[model samples]
Target: MSPTVHEIRNAIRAATGRFEREFEASFTKEELQAICEALKITVDGAGRPSTTRMRQQIRAQVGIAESLETADDSTFRKAELQAIADGIEASSDQ
Candidate 1:
């Protein structure tokens, strides 16, 4: 049988309590509450009901996002891209 909504809610609350307890040990309770509130607000902002699809998208994006930081360690590629654009503009102007 599928879990009832109350069961899911209770499970979520229990998990949140455990998380808060761990965070509170390192940070103030107020900080932990604020962080949780911010996360809830972000999730609730989406008008559509969030489903497993949303979770999968977040996981996929996180995998790529984490790699972007050090994807190219050789040099500053943003600067290189800008220089290439500038060279093209200069060539077009001549």
Candidate 2:
């Protein structure tokens, strides 16, 4: 039987939550930008791109990065974590 719309939405939400936690923990700004480019996602705007924009673009391109194993932390860095946190905080302030 086909899944209900509610079931599909719930499944997507759960997957997105998992992706967000893993992506934030492992990806850097540069890495995200690269992924966006690879996915042909535009990360720029009339002015400089906002982190929120970049993040949305990256999230949309999560499938590209999803192949990587979450158990691998080799690409994770402290600076990237700080950047993600700062961007989130800055957006919240506005």
Candidate 3:
């Protein structure tokens, strides 16, 4: 079954909480605010988290600007390929 709007909203909230916790450890408030702006998310005037529009905006931005048209089959394979390529080129003249 497809997720309801409430479910999606809850998921976003949970993910945002995790992000904020992680960011708090490594970033300043200003940096985190900038990231929020980039994501187009913000709290509404009512004090409730209101990221519905921002989530759509961010998704659209990514969909429109993504350079990768194809999906990566696996993250590990992609990392392995990158490491191999970098190693070969780096060792060529070293």
Candidate 4:
């Protein structure tokens, strides 16, 4: 199942810190793009955003510690990412 708007908000907040331990899942390409916007990180439309690009943007802007960062986009989870789009009413699809 997907997450609630509130949950996504919390997840977004958590992404700046200890993200991996916060959630377990992967955001879709669409959801990842939405997150970048929500976090005020502009994504160059060179192509569809990938996990690496988004993660780099998030890391660069948010400055999540590498020593503390985890391996995957499991930071906020796929559901939370979808909720970001839904909560903001930015996009219809995840």
Question: What are the TM-scores, per candidate, against the unseen true structure?
Answer: 0.23, 0.32, 0.27, 0.43
After superposition, candidate 2 runs with Cα above 4 Å error: 1-25, 46-48, 61-94
Candidate 3 regions with alpha-carbon error over 4 angstroms: 18-60, 64-94
lDDT per residue as tens, model 1, 1-43? 5443333323333434433132212223333233233234233
TM-score of 3: 0.27
> Which 10 residues in a row give candidate 1 its minimum summed lDDT?
85-94
Output the better candidate (2/3) by TM-score: 2
Kindly list the per-residue Cα lDDT of model 2 for residues 1-94, writing each as its tens digit.
5443333323333333323232223344554554445446776668556554565554434432342332222332334323333333312111
Task: Report, for all candidates in order, the number of backbone clashes.
Answer: 0, 0, 0, 0
Candidate 2 to native Cα RMSD, angstroms: 14.6
Instruction: List model 3 lDDT by residue over 1-94, tens digit each.
Output: 5443333333333434423232213233343333345455453355433343332333333343242223232212223322322322212121
For model 1 the local lDDT of residue 35 reads 28
Tell how far residue 1 is off in model 2, in angstroms: 27
Candidate 4 lDDT over residue span 1-94, tens digit each = 5555445544544453323334434555665676677678778777776777776665544445242244234454445455444444443222
Question: What are the runs in model 1 whose C-alpha is more than 4 Å off?
Answer: 18-94
RMSD of each: 21.4, 14.6, 15.3, 10.1
- In Å, residue 23's CA in model 4 sits off its true spot by 11
Q: Candidate 4: what lDDT? A: 0.52
Clashes of 1: 0
Residue 22: error of model 3 in Å?
Answer: 24
Taken over the whole model, the C-alpha lDDT of each candidate is 0.31, 0.40, 0.33, 0.52
